[model samples]
Target: MTDARVMRDRQASVASAARRLDDASGQHSGAALVQTKAVGAYPAAASAYYACTPLRIDGPETEGAAVTFTGDPSRIIMALNLGSRIPPVGTRLIIHSSGGRWAFRYDG
Candidate 1:
């Protein structure tokens, strides 16, 4: 009986952990910096930004970088390293979305 109980508890714990991971991952989405076009939205539009060559925008400092947030999935946010000259469309930009916030990174 004790062994059964231990096994049940372990299973429960594993299930709980898996649930938590799934819930967390569901809150975020990823996309790439395809094209930074000048939309009519002014500041709300995304631009071909530059960062640290191999730029990464994931923190508060990213506020100043050239980019914009539309909403969620599809066109959530678009950005690039502050120093990198606008990469061509289809540039793979690893993106993370959490609580309606975004972070950008160039895996290249």
Candidate 2:
């Protein structure tokens, strides 16, 4: 499936995941797709993030090849999803943690 479609699906799945997380933790932690609007013009960054967190997406990004990075993020996860390229399984990612509302974006 296309990255956009994957992101759209993630948006839908996040709702249910959030509910499940809340049910398990008893805390409200919302999920969203980090979009180009928040990141930049390229979808690579968004896609990279999508591979990481479980954020809801609301826009489109540059199309071509792409890469995804997914794992536990005690911080921010960054990636460059472009073209049809995909990150290898078990790739490490970088994250930046700030005291703010927690959000996630995943495209898998």
Candidate 3:
């Protein structure tokens, strides 16, 4: 019957559309996996601990004195030079002057 044939053709079209959609979904997943792998391959930076008491210094306007944190003096230091107008010794600062750095200290 013509109705049966029409129904079969419609079913075939629906199945084809489903297959294409499935293929697109698979490609999207593959692309996402590749991106994740690429990001994971890069090395992450090490974190430095901030000192409770920060040192205050005096110097020129251009450069600020380096205030080293308590735990790791060598590793962590306020890159701001001595004269740079920075927050007080004990104030916590997200050091934007240099690289994206962070520190906390009010007085010392």
Question: What are the Cα lDDT values of the candidates?
Answer: 0.39, 0.37, 0.31
Per-residue lDDT tens digits of candidate 2, residues 1-108?
999999999898877654434311134433323322233332433334333433322244667545443322333334344324433433332222223223232343
Model 3 lDDT per residue over 1-108, tens place: 699999999899877654533211243121110000111222122132322222233354465555433321222232322222333334434322212232222222
- The residue-level lDDT of candidate 3 at 102 comes to 27
- For model 2, give the 10-residue run with minimal summed lDDT: 93-102
| TM-scores of all candidate predictions against the true structure | 0.26, 0.21, 0.22
Worst 10 residues of 3 by lDDT: 30-39
Which has the higher lDDT value, candidate number 2 or candidate number 3? 2
Candidate 1 least-lDDT 10 residues: 45-54
**Model 3 CA lDDT for position 107:** 28
C-alpha RMSD of each candidate structure in angstroms? 14.5, 17.3, 22.3
Candidate 1 whole-model C-alpha lDDT, 0 to 1: 0.39
Ranking by TM-score: 1, 3, 2
Q: For residues 24-52, write the lDDT of model 1, one tens digit per residue.
A: 12542343323333333323213334221
